[model samples]
Target: MELQVLVLRPIFFFFFFVFLTILQQSSSARVLTITKPDRHDYAASARWLVSQNSWGVLSTLSVDHKGAPFGNVVSFSDGLPEKGNGIPYFYLTTLDPTARNALKDQRASLAISESPLGTCTRDPMNPTCSKLTLTGKLLILEGGSEEAEVAKKALFTKHPEMMDWPKDHDFRFFKLEIIDIFLINWYGGAKPITVDEYLHAKSIKLASFL
Candidate 1:
């Protein structure tokens, strides 16, 4: 009986370890399985970065700091998952310095990277990792308007918690009217993609990447 107990103990531990290893591999696979657009397709690549990401750094000229550039981490959405318009929408309040700075100086930019998407196998700073900066004016939409309604749906769908945020805090919808786009997806310098090329680029179908 003592011999049987000792033999069974090692067998039980071996099986348990195997189960844990399998589970860990499965989880990693799920995270690393994301498919990104080809780096050569500049417009599609830029749109992909914006669509896949839920947040980015929004930089505005600081009103308090005497026109110095101020960058803040902000949550944003282009549209529903796999459906994006290439325009970034944000939910913000005057209570936050970012919102206040935008109101004072509409000139701003939103920077997004592929690092958070888990598709980048290289260092985030590596050129192959891909990054984008959309320079434009940040404008607050009217409380009740056709465009504002669209913004609300686009935002709430991606970030459900925004729907429950404190109303009294006065969070309003804002959008970056992209005037210039800077993208780097490969070893070369910035891509020569025009604004029209980006906004009117073929909409990325989820099936294409999958």
Candidate 2:
């Protein structure tokens, strides 16, 4: 009786509680769910924003706009839902100014926000609504290469419409070779997440920030 009551019973309850806690945490990390990470966790916050958002503003050195900064709304993918690879891939048409400008000059940036995920209680511009800007060379992927195949899978899995886009429209695959990162998820201004930190991030965790 003493063994059962003093050791077994308490141990059983402790394991049960731990199991329940893990289940709840796992449920919160679902693909479509956008529970923001801790504000101080800059890398996780940036990765979370990139993984959750399907579209963003792609800024480039505009050929049409006479060298001014040009921003175009575009759809992109980092990877499959919860298992993103942390690099934004775009399916673009050369007929559009974005791809056209990128070809002329590779310097570019993609900005994404958490507001589209529908988890932010504050205004879209509110500090709590995380945002990330990835700056790098926007390079076009070679057709039929291995990385291009990965790009195709990542894009098609996220944006099904791309598979049906007009094949003759010069739509092609592109990726942002991120060299800089600027993120903001809380009140203290942009968080310092490095390009290496963002790309190698396997998951959104505070420890992954390093």
Candidate 3:
């Protein structure tokens, strides 16, 4: 009886250890799964968010002594997405102080958002808000390059009134070369998208931006 009891005790301990190990692994996997975002869902939602709004806040660092951040509400013309390019690019004109500061500093961020249109009362049909944040470096196009010409033409097409501005004046065309992009859909419930995934899912042709 003593021999039998010792053998059973060792077997029980081994099974118990295996059970705990399996439980720990299961818990870890659950945590990882919860944290991971669904790339497909994020990509689709990000595209929708951009399509919903034509304007966004253009944020740039101040070039003055303060070196603070400044945001401006600007009207933007949307660019179509191309494969390997994340969300579409946008164009807007700015001669304001913010633009000048950004030109001197080159680092900037752009944000676009959309909220429930009518009353504060929440409706199931429109229970959520969305926003996209883009971090990139701004490059000022100078001289007579084909790219500059195309940017000018596209700008004019979006804003016909701009044509009335004097021709001799230096109208700087800025190309935002995106470095990192993030999209939060349904206020953080949906998955988030990184710049690489965005570019991979969409195709942005140069002609479209031009």
Candidate 4:
């Protein structure tokens, strides 16, 4: 019985270490994929918010409503997954009032919340939940431009269905030329992240195993 027990113990210990190794790899994968930037790092936090979200409220001066503020839920991408450039790109058609509004007046702001990312446990209105509003000029890209080509790839990769949308709808690519950034990630008032900081800051480089 003692000889049998000794032989089984080594096998059990070996398997136990194998299990731990597998578990560690799994946890590391989760951290690399979903880890959010520290809230105090305002620029990184802002970029993370923009990159993680696929859609947000894009507000523009309404052309049909006598210049009133118009907010429309729109899909946008900053870049390919985990490799965003901190500039929001959109596929829009003039048939949509939001796109028509942008043509008349380029001033716009995109508001995104941490709620959709599922990282916020508290009420979305809570300051700790984090929110970003990028105010900028919305400009359309000329067809076949180099920047337009890049924007198309970013949009299509993040939103594959966009590639299949009706081409006759006059959908064009537009980007937000961000001027001001308002971010609330913690308790105090909005963080004072400048446009340059937000754009040039090192974004969180979380690797995606998926």
Best candidate (score: TM-score): 1
Report how far residue 125 has shifted in candidate 2, in Å: 1.7
The residue-by-residue lDDT of candidate 4 on 1-210, one tens digit each, is 999899999999999999999999876543335568988889999988888888999999998889999999999999986678999999999899988999989999999998887788899999999999999999999999988987999999888999999989999999999999999999989998999999898857857755
lDDT of 1 at 169: 96
Every model: Cα RMSD to truth: 3.6, 9.3, 20.2, 5.8
Candidate order (TM-score): 1, 4, 2, 3
Candidate number of the best lDDT: 4
List pairs with backbone clashes in candidate 2: none
Q: Give the clash total for candidate 4.
A: 0
How many collisions per candidate? 0, 0, 10, 0
Candidate 3 regions with alpha-carbon error over 4 angstroms: 1-40, 80-94, 116-127, 187-190, 203-210
lDDT of each: 0.89, 0.85, 0.56, 0.90
Better of 3 and 4 by lDDT: 4
Candidate 3, residues 1-210, lDDT tens digits: the string is: 999899999999999999999998866432211122233466655544443344577788876647888887764443422221233233434556656876688887777764521112343333254456778876676647865666565555555676777655555666666787766555445355676666555432223331
Clashing pairs in 1: none
**lDDT preference between candidates 1 and 4, better one:** 4
Q: How far in Å is the alpha carbon of 62 misplaced in model 4?
A: 0.5
Worst 10 residues of 3 by lDDT: 30-39
Candidates in order, TM-scores: namely: 0.85, 0.80, 0.59, 0.84
**Candidate 1: global Cα-lDDT?**
0.89
lDDT score, candidate 1, position 164: 95
